[model samples]
Target: MENNMFCFQCEQTLGGKGCTRHGICGKSPEVAGLQDLLIHMLRGVGFYGQKALEKGRKIDQDTNKFVIDAIFSTLTNVNFDPERFVQYIEKAAEIKAYMKELAGEIDGVIPAAAEYTPPMTREEMLKEAKKFGVMADTSLNEDIRSLRELLTYGMKGMGAYGHHAHILGRMDDTVSHFFYKGLAATIDNSLSVDDLVKLNMEFGQVNFKCMELLDRANTETYGHPVPTEVLITKKKGPFIVVSGHDLKDLKQLLEQTEGKGINIYTHGEMLPTHAYPELKKYPHLVGNFGGAWQDQQKEFDGLPGAILMTTNCLQKPRDSYKDRIFTSSIVGFPDTAHIKEIDGIKDFSPIIEKALELGGWQEDEEDQKILVGFGHNTVLGVADKVIDAVKSGAIRHFFLIGGCDGAKPGRNYYTEFAEKAPEDTIILTLACGKFRFNKKEFGTIGELPRLLDMGQCNDAYSAIKVAVALSEAFECSVNELPLSLILSWYEQKAVCILLTLLSLGIKNIHLGPSLPAFVSPNVLQVLVDNFNITPISNVEADMSAILEAAATA
Candidate 1:
């Protein structure tokens, strides 16, 4: 069959290859094409932005924010509306024009992507989009193409972190400038494989800073995450279930819904919000609702309360609850209610009214709670105990089994690996992947629970911090420590996190359920040779091998 659109940026792409027709996340070919076009225009912006930077011109904060949000919207399952992408393409053209004017008298050659004008009409834009997708430049070598896509996807993830940070009033010029440079590199034919590899690593380093910036923004704005127990059961009242990874949006909603007789519950990535002191202070901020984002359609169907999606990981809403679902902050879907920010504040009163209309659950269910808020501050606050446990062999091994979760078959490896881990091991988890075995009772090793739930995926910074601290105390490199990262990746955010790990010279990361299709065999070999990156084989074999390696080391 002829290909309609090509995208392999996510782990759950069709057949573990490209999504040639429609996205597995319910995005149509038309929407995918428009997203491709939008990315192309953003590259044009980046190209000019780079030239401006070389001329000692500072790119304004507005352009930086626009680029961040635009790139973030192209992430898998973030925005699937074709019209919204068209709007973004138009804005990108405007920004590219502004950047081009700001960057005059360029010295070097300009690529076609830097100077092309976008088509005016939607049909023409869609037609134009087909020429700029993943397979657009077939003349490049397969390995180079793979590396470029890898870098582009990494930047997409960086943009996501940058967007969240920007939302919280945090800005970093170095991080913003790297976005332009990295995006430009994807189209720079003069860059060699080595140059691209170095750029990828540099981008990874910068992304680590970006993640740190986001961590600071979250903690400073909401206060450091404490070890708080979050109730997961339903309560009898009008309620709103907030999903995705935006704490600011959830905070605003909590403020808006205060005393309005609507309780707020978190879903997916937002479950960690309950750990924040500023957010958890709200009396009506009750608990978490569902598990990960992949199960939202079934989880939200016929639900009593309204649902708010603050960021990505949005699937196509089912008809049963589409009317009650709302999108905000760069997440969009056709025909769904979107809460737009007016005067720098999002009015979630629509969602509030919808919740009141629905009347929520009829009766309070039995209370069930899950523990969260084990961020760097929380974990490191008790570092002496953790160090003592390690020294005494009370904690024999440390397993960081976390990343993006998906519906693919092999993801069961993460659950089994966590379940079968020896009693002496400490499992550190983050992101929605924790939903796999979070509810399982893993008894404590001393005072700390065996399964430590570090905040969200971006909170991987927390895990890194703890690892570096442990390595410091043990007088060894992070790799030399008895730690293993068996991660499950589903999207670009996970890609950037993995890059951060590889850039830190951290080794022997077991990533699955499948490797990214965009990673050509040659590029994959580079990763394996340099970082000892391995694909997860089976729960038993991988676990045994990891334990044996730790034991011998």
Candidate 2:
């Protein structure tokens, strides 16, 4: 109830206010304060890096990577260890040190962000953390506060994409350059609301490229996704369940465990990996084991296999499964055994042995399959059919109803909205949010299933590409087409995607389970006036409005 350590980075931030004393995701105030400090220092690093870039000077490659990783540290439920943030804070300052020499002194006046003192120990970092709370500010105006926080939140989302793409050894210099630009702008008080608002849109544009980079990284590594039915039930054997969005980790784990008498299944965002040609080639790479990430604690209870988290969306692992849990990438819990890569090799032997020890459901379980892997290529492969169906009145409209899933009350709205759609309509979904309605059969519109699963959240890029192609075929802009976007968001990645839609001038988006706490009323009005982003209330009313609006259009 107290706003001692303020954070609204997630949908479940306490009471739709701030995670004052602690986080709803089981984060402690100590860790919350440190996260805020880490972000503040990251902006400080951005200030110098961006200033250098302005004078035809270059940003250090390490600076580019550190800024992305530091920003990602602030993502909800990613890192709970206070020590990680402490290290991140010191690392940010270290990047700033190199950036300062590159930038030199600016006009004899050092920007406040350019100021940095390298901490020799943890105590110094803690003392600095006392001063960098999210609410701590130079100006007390609420509008500026809102806009600044909004920019930072948007960049947080952008940073997450950059981090994911970087993991695949894919780096976009253009998108990477803007990371510092956006971060530096957040620390600059001279920028007006208009400036911040414009930067917000640019963040969206860069995020589109960032998401595009990740999509490229994925598709090139694994083949383009095909419409494969992923089994939801676990099969019998010693097994390992991979979670999160990292396909590389999944592929490596699958390869390592192949011929080793172990079964590997996917959990959460890893469901779509079943369709990746390179990953599916390994026979031990079996099926998907559970629903969304939010249900892991319940679904994993007494589960015999090991669980490896590749990225964020990790809940506090329950003690029941914590011993069997392993983590990679930026995800961390205090006692979990983490798999780190040495040169390009990650040793998954620990997870393998643990799975063998616990064994698995020894009896073959009946597998209930969930349809996924309908990426842009697969959908557009049938473009002629889809186009003819739309023109002939067999398919009237398409709904893009997908984003991150979470443990919130209004999430059921997604399930209800998907179920209540007209039979002639096509429902396109992605990300963990698909779990809500994925198992339910939407039948088909001619040869196509009414509900199309377009892989994970990053595959929103595929959805965007599909929409653009659809627009080209119909000779109309995206808004002119009979497509409606109903999105459900939880974390920073969702923020980036929403900004992407807004940047593309996509309008009339119905966003829920709730409006972002980071979006101020003025910013919300700006979104409404410029992009017509609406918050969802009643599913029946919203669906009727969408249908009625499309009918008129």
Global CA lDDT computed for model 1? 0.92
lDDT of 2: 0.84
List model 1 lDDT by residue over 1-553, tens digit each. 1349999999999998899877898889988888888889988888999999999998899999999999999998888777898899999999999999999988879988999899999999988988999998778799999999999999899989999999889999999999899888888999999999999999889999999999999999989999999898889989999998999899889888888999999999998889999999998999998899999999999998899999988999999999999999899999989999987799888999999999999999999988998999999999999999988989999999999999988888898999999999999999999999998999999889999999799999999999999999999999999999999999999999988999999999999999999999999999999999999999889888988988888
lDDT of 2 by residue, 1-553 (tens): 2336778878988899788776888887777777877777777778887878888897756668888888887888688877777778777777888888888867644556568564666666666666777777656566677777777777777777788788788999898888778878776768888888888888888889998999898888888988887767767778998888788888888778878899888888888888888887788877888889889889888788898999877888888898999998788888789888898789999999999999888788676887777999899999999999999999999998899899979899999999999999999999999999989989988889999889888888999999999999999999999999999999888888888888898999999988988777887898999988889999889999989988887
- Candidate 1, poorest ten consecutive residues by summed lDDT: 1-10
* TM-score list, all predictions: 0.99, 0.97
Give the best candidate by TM-score: 1
- TM accuracy, model 2: 0.97
Model 2 misplaced regions, further than 4 Å: 1-3
TM-score quality measure for candidate 1? 0.99
Displacement of residue 124 (Cα, Å) in model 2 is: 4.0
- List where candidate 1 sits over 4 angstroms from the true fold: 1-3
